[model samples]
Target: MLAHIGGRGFPPDEAAERAWATALWERTGGRPSGAPVARQIDAIRASGDRTAELRRITAPTLVVHGDRDLLVHPSGGRATAAAIPGARHVEIAGMGHHLAPGVLDRLVDLTTALARTHGARPATTPTPTPAPAPPTEEPA
Candidate 1:
């Protein structure tokens, strides 16, 4: 999982990877299981092309992909965006299959922009404010 997340031009973030690993361990009760992952991969492989179906989608679509993604090449994203009529494609730099440190914020911004463009209103619930930055210590 770490290898897949960090490879393909994305530098390894040890802290983030360790946190993710811990989360996964907690979720699965520390059981060594490859069946689920294998099944997902097999299912993806078994699914045939759906270009015609993709083209039939009428809703506004946004395709965001990492240019450096090794799991699925950027060309696949390009092809998907091309198939969907009026689908906007955004290629992010220095990202892989998994979300890196700064990618989440960028994704959120892109999603918000797309939603606003499509006349979607923001949720009524108040958004959480970020914590104040720590004061820098001065050198004596």
Candidate 2:
């Protein structure tokens, strides 16, 4: 499962892989658990083609995929972008299905730029209403 999600050249660091495996093992009560992994595989298999629905999307869409992604190939991203109207596709080189160091920041920046370009406004906190003016004291 890790290999499928992380790609063949994933981790790039044996220590990182060991740490991840240890954490996963701890999370799974130290027993070799395959339920979650099986579920992910099943989900992928069950997901039917949604190209028609994808083409119907009118909102500004961004399809970002790792060029080295093994689970979902870059072609999938290209096809998704092609299907959506005016969708932008970004292929990051040397990245895989798993999040690599510093990739999240790049993704955030890309999304932020896209949102800015598309005039997406950040949620604003509503200004608090001023307290009702204290009742004026009656003149003697």
Top candidate by lDDT: 1
- TM-scores of all candidate predictions against the true structure: 0.77, 0.73
Candidate that scores best on TM-score: 1
Q: Compared with the true structure, what per-residue lDDT tens digits does model 2 show for residues 1-140?
A: 55556654435455777898899899878999778879999998898898999989998899989888877878999999999999999988767898755477788999999999999999999999999988889899
lDDT (Cα, 0-100) at 140 in candidate 2: 100
- Badly placed stretches (over 4 Å) of model 1 are 1-13, 125-140
Query: What is the TM-score (0 to 1) of candidate 2?
Result: 0.73
Give RMSD to native, each candidate. 14.0, 5.4
Clashing pairs in 1: none
Report backbone clashes per prediction.
Answer: 0, 0
Error of 2 at 113 (Å): 0.7
lDDT for 90 (candidate 1)? 96
